[model samples]
Target chain A: MAAKKLNIKDKYRLLTRDLDWDFSYEDPKKAFPYEEFEGIKITDWNKWEDPFRLTMDSYWKYQAEKEKKLYAILDAFSQNNGHLNVVDPRYVNAVKIFLTGVSPLEYQAYQGFAHVGRQFSGVGARVACQMQSLDELRHVQTQIHAMSHYNKFFDGFQEFSHMHDRVWYLSVPRSFFTDARSAGPFEFMIAIGFSFEYVLTNLLFVPFMSGAAHNGDMATVTFGFSAQSDEARHMTLGLEVIKFLLEQHEDNVPIVQKWIDKWFWRGTRLLTIVAMMMDYMLPNKVMSWKEAWEVYFEEAGGALFKDLARYGITMPKYADVIEKEKEHISHQAWWTFYTHGHAAGFHTWIPSDQELDWLSEKYPDTFDKYYRPMWELAKEQEAKGERFYTSGLPQLCQTCQIPMLFTEMDNPNQNSMRDTVFDGERYHFCSDGCCDIFKDEPEKYVQAWLPVHQIFQGNCGGPDVGDILSDYYRMNVGVDNMDIKDSPDEQRWNKWKGVA
Target chain B: MSKVYIALQDNDESRYIVEAIEESNPDATVIHMPAMIRIEQENRLVIERKVVEEKMGRDWDVQELHINLITLGGNVDEDDDQFVLEWKQ
Candidate 1:
């Protein structure tokens, strides 16, 4: 018996890419339908390069380490009265939001990446897709396992899967990803790889890790940090994809330029939720959205755009949109958290006077001038034993499904409004494009499964507010009294508060 | 309209390239293909070797092209006929 050996290039060209063949009697575009719609050209598929020289053995080894680490944390949290260990039941609402808003996106990422693996024209891209698909699946499973520990002690945890599918806020993410999925593969690269991963993933991962660390959530911090480590590689892929497109064809520069404009705006709007969560949800906030933006986007990404200027492109069209909304997004989400948190799995209390001063110092430009008055009103309400919910369902922007808080392009104060008629019923949108999209397919947009509406309709498994909050959202009613728990950590926190 | 093709390492670099191009030409139209960015310029599109050379600096090598690119679409032609950079409109 004899063993045959293949050289590196030979193995790649022969075993991997060389095996692909043009199908007989089928249009190439149909076989690869997404490639031609936007009118970008590709004469040779072989020039693509795979940066990661990964093999199956290496892949499995790394994956196993990730799983072992994650499962251990889940076990510790489950067995050690982890729910009782938290600073407050309100703090657990952050976890509830994670379960409902973000965990499902991981599954969607897995499916989308699987399509990436199978449909990409380049072998390296296929490999990238494979790796990301697996990573996404891991994220989903890990998030579920970690959050499930609180399911016994909290409310809203149970209804997350259902809520994710039907909530107004949830529509933003679902629609955004669906838009990418509907596009050609190259557009997907632009939307997810370039726009989402490269420009914003750092913005996302850093906050998650930093906030978790600040809150003594070692498990979440560890998982987020680990995920961020992998994100760096994905970011590189995004950068490479953009460059390759421009260098590949002089014509491609402009086509990619449009996608950058469109998707950059789209992705930034979608990340409003992240911006709000980072700035508001945590009892111990780390970085303001403004500061994070300056460091991550302004410093790092702004420099990258400067370097890119030589290649004949500009910053995305809606760069100013993200910049302008920084203060408002966090402000609105905090308001939401402060008001609705009691009904959900989390708790919300007035910030200590010290925390208020800290906030003022952190947001010198706007906090004192604009927000302090609002906070004072809230405090007065709390003192009087009255809490406010804005009485009616908010008018969600069709594109982002955030309340229509975004002002005009430059005027951050003047409300932006757009409308479209669907099935002869007029719908208001915060932006023109969103209205247009809804108008194009009225049926799709009209069927939105809004979460607030569900709660009002008494669909969340309870006869009253307390029952629903406990059974569905997963709030702690009995075990530890939320912030004043039986844990040593709570004792220490209480003692520290007494000192000041 | 001329057709071109560019190959790069991944999509992020494709974005950099697109941004670079749009910086110079704001109205430029772009289309995305599986592994490339296709551009259709109403006028001419040029890639000054000196520009790439200057940015890459001492690390510049033609083979590094693979490390730098991820998008290839729209009127792109590079590396003789072996690689097509642009998609024909």
Candidate 2:
């Protein structure tokens, strides 16, 4: 009789588990040094189940196929002048923000996963992280390639990597990743692999990808599809990691819970940018930020937490606050960028009358009452040739690094600011959640590279915002940082489309 | 009985999987939204590897369903043959 063929499970075990060597000369503890530092107990590495039965050979084969398909679409898009096919010139600002603000996070994810991939004792986890690290690298590359065509025409697409490191608002995302990467391997898994990839990834990818499709951005939409295929493996790894840790020992439950709370709050704060993009940036909107939050977070996350409850895990702390903030953050974040348009890397403008009405309809209880009046005042100022730009810099939350733009959830007019002293220095936060996160680790947050603080300390090039914008952040001043109404971007678009 | 659901991106790849699912679980309700397709069933939902392979006219690995999976609810029991989702009592 012929020998039985090896199944996928057997092949995966051989490729992953069988590759691990028994430590003889060196201690395993010294090898995987970061494993136990985060208070997570992993009693047995053998209990770690491989989430996806994929060998390195199959992974390369699949990714190569995806890259082939993605590059073909990107080529077609460039050859066909896909930039002109968008719904409106304003739509490109969303892509600008994405390329600058979000793509760099993919690179950070790659570095993070690669680092943790080396630190985990479980071969299954190491293989999983190694695969996700590659996935993130591919995502960033494809994202850059997809947007490179737009860079030929758009103003703000340049200097994204430089701006990611030095810009004021870009620090919000940068610090989030740096914080995760700085943690021990177990916390890194919970912070990124589980909390971010499993719980919050849909909120990030689905809206942006769907927004791309709705707005006729073929290159971006194609890349979104390509990256999403890899997201499944990442997400399954996230789920598996959490389950393995939770089931290993009862003590790990609280540690994992605290991480879920911390990362969940941080993830929501980072997604405020996404909320603004969905509500204001996309000319052909996919859905209101509030609606997307409901579908993605409230309903879907609710179901996930229900399953997690069996392991003594409840819904994340402050989920109610996040629910309320969904109704408010998008409006508030847009207003912040609008007032500070001169400092922002992307163009900002008062929403059209139709958009204001849409906001009122979607946010029936709050928009007309609180937000519409503010837009009306801005419109009045613009009509009077006194287009509003706040000269003074706003205070930023030490934890989230977002300018303290968010309002009190209960009172839309009241700022939800909190402050506490650590080591004889006063630290401020935007909300109770942020304040708590800071207090939990004051030493880590006190070292935050706050842009506003750096500028005030004579560290960011010069005194004037324009000097810093151009010299330090590499923004092109008037060309890159202003309203879309009369900027070079708009003018060029009009000239190309013959809108005389 | 509580409902279990799985959402997949609305694309050509998922259409075959969705067809196989609908045929297998006759009581499942399929809802199509913008850029996404959701299938929900009370108590349990199953996706058989053989059925999807038959529908696609090619060999299909159970793990390939995740290529388009957006999100899912309930406890999951997956293997080489089939993927099952249900609420644990």
Candidate 3:
């Protein structure tokens, strides 16, 4: 006999809502004592609602379908020798950045969401977090699988697990996720869900995916589009948590706003790599990094804060810094890579004449004024057989752990440097934003895994660049790094174009 | 102001919706965002389910838009077939 079918809302109410208990043995607060540490007061947990109303049955079904679709694309592409059909060899830099900097972060997210799922008091929050945990694990697996095809032929991708932990540029992402994973459940949600996923995910994904699509990387584009589809649900969870907190109690507003301020800046700083990837990395441009900020961050974020003003919340405090820095960030990041990319896995080159013209066209206000002359000089140096590559390790930011490469806001010649001394040990930051983060939590920032500092302290392999590059970084400079013209990738691609 | 606006939380579902809106309303300006997409068009913005289905490459119900719908400005004239946003005379 067939039993009566139930609608999705009823199923969610039964599976998620019906599972909550009014503990008979002890106080509910005592059972979920971890919730009280963050000082967020939730008057009633019933106020929370899953926007998608998904039950476990639907969740498994949906995920299995997506997984099937993903593997099919990967299998077919593998049979076709998809790596050879790429638009340019340089586009693989974007993929390298993703594998090295972004993939391990997904694994971190998996751990984070799993902990939050078990720790949070609310059934709804727990279920959403649990689902997201599974999603993140799927993301990491799928990403590794998608890029594994390239790994068979590529040089730099062979050592992502090692590089993410010990490399200089990669520490920016590693520490960012580590900080979130170690925080309390509520703070983790606000830090990752509300601030990172909800506030600034577009800037991270759009340029990379767009570059993949235009660069003839069908596998990467497929992976990115699939992951981006999941991000919408993650974003909803972010928005829902903030609203649930605000609606539960008025006191939760100020605490939530502080987290928003703190994480917004932190997330923005981590994106400096992406800014360079968008402007200097892509062979075919979708939009400049500056244009992406205006389209994605400013316009969309402005409307959101206006909506949230009803809860007496304000926009991020350091938004002006973001606006002012956008014009210079891509240029600064590219220059840093051009000089110091040998320490890392990816390569860098001076922009071609057409590429430099595109930069000026996209960044008319500042590129010509401040950044172009540096590239022009590099071009002349290349002509004279004097291409510059820095052998000195960069001074690391105590908070973000990136190099101290940002320039002074007004003075082009001076570096934008800030520092503070805690417990007789001096700490340096690249900008006031990073300094503020350090000042708030000296103990936390003090323990950062700064790569350059570790290198100096004889922690990462050894002091010698040769030992460090091969033994520690697992990279061969001439193979992993390139000058475009003399690269094996270029030579291999030339055969297909009949230019060989 | 002779403008109508529609806002949907930026997600996979709404990517198709935004693409559909752009196709139907050529004058509509989409504001890309971190968690949402907002579209503003002069006087009226039409959302055709046909365009959304084509963009998504699947069968899509017009009502599915509400799952990721955040907030919209202008009178929402919604039905099973389509959703139209415009100001009254």
Best by TM-score: 2
Over the stretch A1-500, how does candidate 2's per-residue lDDT look in tens digits? 99997777887889777898889999988998888878888899888886457788778877887788789889999999999999899889988888988899999999999999999888888898999999999999999999999999989998999999999999999999999999998898899988888767777777667888888898887787678778767776887888899999999999999999999999999999999999998887778999989877887677777778889999999999998888898999999999999999999999999999899999998899889998999999999999999978889999999999888887889988999998999999998999999999998999999999999999999878889999999999999988998899999999999996
True contacts kept of each: 0.00, 0.15, 0.00
lDDT of 3 at A122: 86
| iRMS of each prediction | 13.8, 3.0, 8.5
lDDT of 2 at B41: 89
Which consecutive 10 residues in model 2 chain A have the weakest lDDT in total? A49-58
lDDT of residue A377 for candidate 1: 88
lDDT of 3 at A401: 81
Q: TM-score per candidate, in order?
A: 0.72, 0.96, 0.88
Q: DockQ ranking from best to worst?
A: 2, 3, 1
Stretches > 4 Å off in candidate 2: A1-3, B1-5, B66-77, B85-89
Residue range A167-213, candidate 1, lDDT tens digits: 54566787677777767788788888888887677677665556665
Best by lDDT: 2
| lDDT string, candidate 2, B55-80, tens digits | 99999988677557766655566778
Q: Which has the higher lDDT value, candidate number 2 or candidate number 3? A: 2
Rate residue A17 of model 3 by lDDT: 79
The whole-model lDDT of each prediction reads 0.61, 0.88, 0.80
TM-score of predicted structure 1: 0.72
